[model samples]
Target: MKELHIVCKVRKKRYRYISQISNKITPNLLKRDFKKDDPNIAWVTDVSEFRFNRKRLYLSVIQDLYNG
Candidate 1:
């Protein structure tokens, strides 16, 4: 029977780097209020884009929350 000894080298510790810059918060105007008592009083609009055959297409829609 024979005895063996092993040796290992230590390496320097590394830390994660993060940016110190802060992001600005924007205020919301609607504040999640989507209810309306009368028609045409409140409306929501949305826009979307799609790409097909190396071309760009855009679609815009307006929705009325009152019975629509």
Candidate 2:
């Protein structure tokens, strides 16, 4: 997270980075097994992740266009 402090004396705002307590959502596993007889579904997603520091983290998302 980041914070922007506004001050009249400075031309630009000050920014502070805040660490997070929990990790973000990331993709860990994937599987696809669908037949032509399957019903129509548009979207699917997977998510898991890891946090490096109070201010840093990695996140990922996996998506499928068709039902599979």
Candidate 3:
């Protein structure tokens, strides 16, 4: 790999900045119901990280639960 000029990229570990734990709890508004009848209602979002071509990339996706 060194003779062909190919380098490997290593992934680093991420750490949290906060040290204290909170006791607050958030209510579940969806109630485990993911199915939706309306097109614009019940939108969900997710963030993902990917390593490709020796570069790190972040992807954010937002989709409607009705058709998705």
lDDT tens digits by residue: candidate 2, 1-68: 13666555655756776676457777543344433343444345555556566555556665445545
Task: For candidate 2, give the lDDT of residue 1.
Answer: 19
TM-score, every prediction: 0.51, 0.26, 0.59
- Residue 53 of model 3 has an lDDT of 100
Worst 10 residues of 1 by lDDT: 1-10
| Model 1 lDDT per residue over 1-68, tens place | 13556566797867777788567788876587787678887788999989899899999999887766
Write down the TM-score for model 1. Answer: 0.51
The true-versus-predicted C-alpha distance at residue 38 of model 1, in Å, is 0.5
The top-ranked prediction according to TM-score is: 3
- Candidate 3 lDDT tens digits, 1-68: 99999999997989877859787899988898999988887889999989999899999999899999
- Candidate ranking (TM-score, best to worst): 3, 1, 2
Best of the two (1, 2) by TM-score = 1
Candidate 3 regions exceeding 4 Å error are: 1-14, 19-23, 52-55
